[model samples]
Target: MNIFSRRARLGNAWAVNVRLRIAQGKIATIASAAEPQAGDVVVDTLLPALANLHSHSFQRAMAGMTEYRAQDRESFWTWRTLMYRFLDHLSPDHIAAIAALTFMEMQKAGYAAVGEFHYVHHQPGGQAYDNPAELSLQIIQAAALTGIGLTHLPVLYTYGGLQAQPLAGGQLRFGNSVDAFCDIVSLSEKAMAALPADTCIGIAPHSLRATSESDLRQALDLHAGMPVHMHIAEQTKEVEEVAAMRGARPVEWVLGQCEVNEQWCLIHATHMTESETAALAKSGAVAGLCPITEANLGDGIFNGASYVAHGGTFGIGSDS
Candidate 1:
């Protein structure tokens, strides 16, 4: 058992001489405005822990590697090309080590949990491993070792771009059929069963560009009742391409085609019109914003003022 006395925030007010009783690694009870015992540990301040709702932990190694002038006109697409090259050589051991170090740093920074949007599933040559969940289990092991809560989102990345284009270049490793994707999710769920009680397994359709409407529906059905996440409308080019192909913006298409609600998180809804923004806000989905990554990639600013005014929910992420 653990006991501590500190000045703690209770909802909108602060309470002094608050005592917390921790048992079985959880807070068993809390007492407000109470005197401390002789053996109590006193602290001057306390704060609630934060959750990083989006992360690609393996990308931490490539943080400063792409800061130089690679092209005459550097952009998100250019940076992505560099990232693809970087991941082309990362072994499972490398992924695990990087993820463990990243999760440890997050814990030190007061993060209680993380949502990992994992996509790399195959080997360097785009061959499936003997076990489909091999790479996913590596990430799960990293989370278990670091004592951080996990929400593992196994991504379904079938195509390279709009119109169901074939996977090319570094995108080869993330490709899988819808049936194969379901098997991976099932195996990943079993692999995560030994983890802490709070660990979650979810579905991620990389984006509208990477998945078709049918594939998206199948993935959602495969992991029904779980939190669903996707990258949406992060770039102007993406918005334009989606509009050109589907005759609708990305957000508009998703909101109309799917039943997005509280269990959904649309990451980087950065490029949206006023109507799209208001419509998504009414859908009760969380906006997964990553300001640091957005600024680094030169993605446009999210309409936070309008979104929050419409009673939209939001959560921050380290989308690296």
Candidate 2:
């Protein structure tokens, strides 16, 4: 396939009357100072599509429902309580429908791919479905339907809090032993075989507060070199809880414990200190920022200026 654009942004500059050749679902070649051909798809403006690096597709169904204030002092925790209640009623069919719509909207908005940070795994009562990857297959099917490149992240959520508390309420659906999570990843890999080659699987260790050091290590070891994503310092309460239990802030502790690099993406690293920001900038890991969701949840602003000044890499996500 060939595409001729009157104005197209190629790298850092714009070219007039450029032609791009698509071969095997990828751009094979680009030619500038070209004329319109007889059989070419023409467009006025063309730019590279983006990848939404973090998202929870199931939450897209509860979009406008959570905007109402249920309390005088509304916060992320309070909004989370309502989200838990809302998710209890979603079946696998509902998950597929919601995910399909979310992926379609992402494509319409110029996103060619998404990294779904999926966590809702089991039935509402904490019981496993006949297949461990039931919900995961739904996400895979949705991505297939929308033709979106998917990096499905099966999150390992073991506990409820930083101190290894038992799972409760909606957290029950997300809870899984390290062994069970491995099974889910294995089954999900099998299900993704029907999708395009670019559709792949990754692992997420929900967050510092939700997993122990031992559990996190086990989850990391499950996927040898795949993309690793984790929720870091998103909320102040979470930061305090992790610091109290682990004796260091979330970013500082993870940096000390892990060999973070380009393959890792730390989501919502919104509450970092000067040293933590500098260290993360130098670590070669992508800072996954979800500005819209961060603002909605009242999560603090990321240190973008300072991080960029230090030559950091970052990506944007919807995260809903």
Candidate 3:
């Protein structure tokens, strides 16, 4: 029995007449009508919301907090230094508070879900918490508290490069060998059970700057059927470094070695050759473009005009 029915105009050219027969929490049916039943409640219009394809919830606290212009070269790398410093002061409770604040803003801005690229997974001093996935679990808690759909991408960051060098100082808390990292990833899945069961768990390799061949392979293999997101070719220096270490460019090398498909999201692939761009489009992965953040960080524009011309599927991200 429909309690309410009403004709509603949707967007600029669609008339949606909703007859909501609610039972529990599900929508029973929608039909064309303009009648109000006893105790009926009618609405105007409804539509599916957007998903924030990438986010660093902890970074929300540091937003507009890094505006000072240093005498030295001010770049994303420099900004990253400040980001690391900010994380040092973030306790689990503080992280959740920050996430809650940001997620509330996201919801107000029409984002229904957030794919949190959570890599900050330990104490400030790089020690594991009582639960190895404590920081990640905090993010899940924040999303639940704020009523945001959660997509947890626990990052597996190992090695400084192909050389497997020690992690840089700021990257200390992000360290985990392949085995330990995968175990923590599994733990993150357990953490998700406390959230919406529809939550998706994916793997983030951090970047080519943070992983080796064997390390990336293990993360990908353990991903089951989840999407794989990574930072690739964001900076010119990164592209040169990856090429110097391997024989090919970052994305080219990755597509050659890894099994990439629609189940992948490449974040900030801001630098690429024509071949790389064409090949990536052919792979069917969504490009996670953070236009506002890229402009803020002076990370250069993605050749979006060209990528879309090539029939690429892209989704926007608020990766603060």
Candidate 4:
């Protein structure tokens, strides 16, 4: 059973004295102008919850540690070096602990669900664990422990740069061939079977620079038309790189190459031309915005006013 009040911003605008009868863990009925009776539970206030559309749960462990200004010109690239170092030492146990605490914090912050864009798949030396989904299972367990909805988006990261460079240094952990990535996806789906029914699985091609055109096609074909996400135009360098490598802008190349509809979410689409912005808005894909992280990373502001004017869809996340 549940109840809501307009005074607490918890109920529909038209609802008064709202009550919900839950059955089988689902709301069976909603009634307004209802009165509490024998054995009824009540709260003075309640609030609606939101979904965190993008997250790197393990990075929650290194939150305040990366703020130090070690270099004269620190940017996203430099911040990533610290991130790589932090993840280099994480065992499955560490991942679980960090994820559990982070998920608990998200729950406390009123996030009912989280879309984890998980990429740490291999051991420190880039060796696959006996279970390919070892880190993924840890994330799932964390979500299960906290009762937070999980939308697991396993990231496919293959190349080092726009020129299809080989994975170098710390990136080895995130590299997987098409066949190996498919195996991991299959294993992740099986691992989630014992999880809550609301748990979902999605694919994330790490970014235009990390994936080739053929690789993107393979990822999408393997996805079977589920929710697809990609990191696009997060940095100006990335936009320039895609243009130099692909002869078109990142969003432009994607819109021409893929069937981007409501099932697609372009994360960190911070840099775009007016035409690209309008085209993306007309494409019906969501712009997954991480406002806090964008600010922290010095990523530019999104064209929110224009995008919203064109009926673009978007969702919020704390992209750690």
Candidate 5:
């Protein structure tokens, strides 16, 4: 028996005689019936770890080195070109090695789980790999190796924008049709099922620009009932184009068209109208924010104060 009584929680007060019974790597029982013995270890406090709701684990390596300049008006678009150059060189093994290093740091920082928004699927030339989901599996392997929870959200990138343009050279690996994306998602799900119950697969449509209405509907139907994620309103040019093409803003368009519920995470809803902001806050979906990356990319300040006041739920990410 162990006496573990305290009016406070999680570093608020000390714990005494908090003997733990472990069953299959889980706590089976906590006995607080008696005092601590002489050799008993004393713990100050304990709490369940938090989750990083979004990440591109491989890009963690590129965090601080992207601020160089070549000419005037160096914007996010110019920075993206540099990112393409960075991504062009990574193979599955290289990505796995990088991810393992990053995840170890995340564990030490107290993030027990990471939701990876993955998109690099094929080779640089957009050719199918021997293992279509090879890169994704590598990330999963890294997460397992580092002892952090993984929610693998594979991204679906189709066209470049509302113009239905072809993907540029840097975007080849992220390109996927509705059929190909479904196949990869299925394969990822089967692989994720082999992990602990806490590890699972989620779906991601890269953004409104990347997928047509038909493609979006197809993916939604295919991955129905799964946690879904998407990038939205991260840049003003994107907002302008989306508004011009669809006559509705990105977040507004998505909320009007699809089911925006708790199972969805709208990444980077940085630009919003008052109505859109209020609606999103009430929508029960997680608003994925990357404040550090946002500042680096000049993505503008998100309405954090208003969103919180409206009862919005959000989680941090390292979007790279």
Candidate 6:
């Protein structure tokens, strides 16, 4: 396919009458300052598509449902309570439909790919479906339908809190033993085979508050050479909880424990100290920022200027 743009951003500079040749599913060649050719798909402006580094597609369905304040002080925790209630009524089919719409919207908004941090597994009552990866397969199918490059991240969520609390209510659907979670990842891998070669699977430990140190280690060891994602320091309450139990803040503790590198993407590293920000910036891992969701939930602003000044890498995501 040939694409010609009257004005196009090529790398860091904009060029007039730029032409692009797409072969298979990738841009094969770029000819800047070129004339329009026959049968060229012409456009006014063109730019590179982005990748949504973190998302929970299922929550896209709950877009307007959680906007209003239902408590004395509306917060991320209060919003989470409503989210859990909302997910308790969703089935695999509902997940697939919602994911399809979400992926479609992402594409329409110039996102060529998404890293779906999917954690909702099993039925509402916490029973394993006939197919353990039923929800994973549904997400894969939705990506296939939308033709979005999917980095399917199956999240390992074991506990309810930082202190290894038992799972209850909506948390049950996300709970799985380390072995069971590994099996689900394997099954999800097989299901992803039907999609494009770029459609791949990664693992997420949910968060330090949701999984134990041992389980996080096991999960990390299981997926070598693949992307590893985790939620860290999204809320002050979560930071306090993790610090009280682990003796360090979420980002600080994970940096101390894990060999964080380019493959790791920490979502919502919102609350970080000067030392933590500097350490994370030097760690070579990507900070996944979800500004809209953070603002909606009243999560604090990320230390973007300082992190960028330290040469840290970051990406945006529609986390909701």
TM-score leader: 1
| Candidate 3 error regions (>4 Å) | 1-46
Candidate 5 lowest-lDDT run of ten = 1-10
Give the runs in model 4 whose Cα sits over 4 Å from its true position. 7-16, 22-28, 33-47
Give me candidate 1's TM-score against the actual structure. 0.94
lDDT of every predicted structure (CA atoms) = 0.90, 0.93, 0.82, 0.87, 0.85, 0.93
In the range 92-165, model 4's lDDT, one tens digit per residue, is 99999999998899989999899899898999878999998888889888888888989999989999888889
Instruction: Write model 2 residue lDDT over 1-320, tens digit each, in one string.
Output: 99999999989999999999999977899999999898999999998899999999999998988776777889898888989999999999999999999999999999999999999999998999999889999999999999999999999999988779999999999999999999999999899988877788999999998888998898887688989999999999989988888899999999999989999999999999999999999999999999998998889999999999998999999998
lDDT of 6: 0.93
Cα distance off (Å), candidate 2, residue 126: 0.4
Candidate structures ordered by lDDT, highest first: 2, 6, 1, 4, 5, 3
Cα deviation of 179, candidate 2, in Å: 0.7
Over 4 Å off in model 1, which ranges? 1-17
Better of 1 and 4 by lDDT: 1
Clashes of each: 0, 0, 0, 0, 2, 0
lDDT of 5 by residue, 147-206 (tens): 889999999999977888999888888999999898899888888777877798889999
lDDT of 1 by residue, 1-320 (tens): 54555688877788888888887878788888888788777788766688899999989999998877766898899899989999999999999999999999999988999999999999986899899888999999999999999999999999989989999878988999999888888898999999878799888899999999888998888678988999999999989999999899999999998889999999999998999899989999999999998998889999999998998889999888
What number of backbone clashes does candidate 2 have, counting pairs of residues 3 or more apart or in separate chains?
0
True-vs-predicted CA distance for residue 257, candidate 3, Å: 1.3
- lDDT, model 4, position 120: 89
- The regions of model 6 sitting more than 4 angstroms off are 6-17, 22-29, 42-45
